[model samples]
Target: MDRAFRWAFIGTGTLAKKVAREITASERHVIATAYSRNREKLCAYCEPYNAYPAISIEDAIDRSDVDAVYINVTNESHYEVCRQALELGKHVLLEKPFTMNASDTEKLQNLAKSRGLYLAEAMWTWFADVPLQVRAFVQSGKLGRIREVYMSYCAYSIGYAPRVSDPLLGGGALLDIGIYPITYAYRLFGFPLSITCNGDIKNGIDYGEHIVLGYDGFDVKMDVSIVDTKGEAMIIEGENGFLANPGYHYGESAVAKTKSGVDIFKGQRSYLKEFDSVADEIRQGKTESSFIPPQATLDCMRILDECRRQMNLVYPFE
Candidate 1:
């Protein structure tokens, strides 16, 4: 906390640009280096923040100034890039879906553990307060034994995200927008007893999916899409009442209804919270995050692997 947290960014795409804007806005963080396949785009991304645009992935992480690496590269490159950073003795905060499969996720996790390097999946929902508050409300018995739950994170991302339909890039609705709802379910109910998935696959990639996570007493049904727009909504229904959020993944607030009355829970929604929290943890000499723990990430990846297996959604690179 005494010095600014320096970050080496491995990708300069849309997500990386947005995160850079937030990180540069604060004095506690700095984009010490950045890399991209496109040299022109990389330079453009680094100018506003006055960051050093590295020529390669190794150039970005090899610098002594960088305390951690923030990776938002193509999904297929997640494991290799994270492994490179950890091998270089730099902390890593990777974008989700952690890896293409659980096996690779576990490998990277074990590598970090063995080297005593900090590593985490940047699943921002848990860092937000609303979902945690909702979890607390449900656990408090205010929801009176949850009976059913449904979440939808469908959007027409095909036109904008060509990568969503590109199998070579590890593209699919399950890895794109699907991760939010899946991680949300895992965080609330832990691992499911049974996992079932029905998906629409076109041109070697998944366009959408209907996933059901079966628990002991109830079922959590989730719908995710890249070619269709079903609207983003989340609801946790219990014997007493239900909790609803219009934009569940990134929304700042939610409403809980019961026999007695209605209550609203609010929280901060900025992406910077995730980065700052990780930086602070690393600064404190912690190798793991309390918000997005290693076990939670591995569990979510296992669920994703099972869903992919059922849907037969395989990328060419995988």
Candidate 2:
């Protein structure tokens, strides 16, 4: 309602801290307060932004000064936390992998729609400039009728960290890291008609997975691993030429090559771009983002659900 949105964060973890820093640094938004179970840790994280730390989640959500709530909790707790925020009539910007499955995502979407509240999944990559440029190029027919997409995101966690190996915390490559490549493909090509998955599992959780997603005219082959390292790149092939990003997943640039030669496209971090979208949605009093709609989030969840089912990976919460 005001020129700047008053924001509160639900988790004071590393990601939350980073976002808090961004929000505080920006003039368009202000950090009103932050909520975390660990008061000491929350205070420490909020100190840089001079944000007051709420003693509990309820206090944070119910604060009259707070205009929106950012849900940055663990994977298993995202749904519940977001539900509470929505119930409190606070707009929410949820972290990626919105939920463990489509059913929960649908429930949240429906709830937000019913409450006339704005709810968004923080898929920051979708708001990036390079992706937008790539999409524009594709739409312009430069890359004729996209033929294939290949992506790989992996890191060796042989030492078996709790977050990477634990089943109780919704640990796995698919939910944790694989969702990036999956979402990237979905953003470019939409949900595939069919998907096949092969995974390495330990203690009933997926450590690594190779997923092949099939569409009518194109195919997406993606690999995500916790026990191995991948090149962390994305390749898009079309009938005419192709676009390749050596550091595709989190890079600042990409290269497009055809029969002629190579053309480089440079970009900067676009995470803050999504904040403008969020601000516009709030200003318009819209319940959903036009750029990253609820249906897209639901589709992503469905794909992840199917991938996990095929891999026989199950989290304790599920």
TM-score of each: 0.98, 0.93
Taking the tens digit of each residue's C-alpha lDDT, what string does model 1 give over 131-245? 8898788778888888999999988887676567788888889998888999999888899999999999998988899999999899999999987788899999988999999
TM-score of 2: 0.93
Q: What TM value does model 1 have?
A: 0.98
For 72-110, candidate 2 gives per-residue lDDT tens digits of 887888899999999998999999889889999999999
**What lDDT does candidate 1 reach at residue 197?**
95
Say which candidate scores most in lDDT: 1
lDDT of 2: 0.82
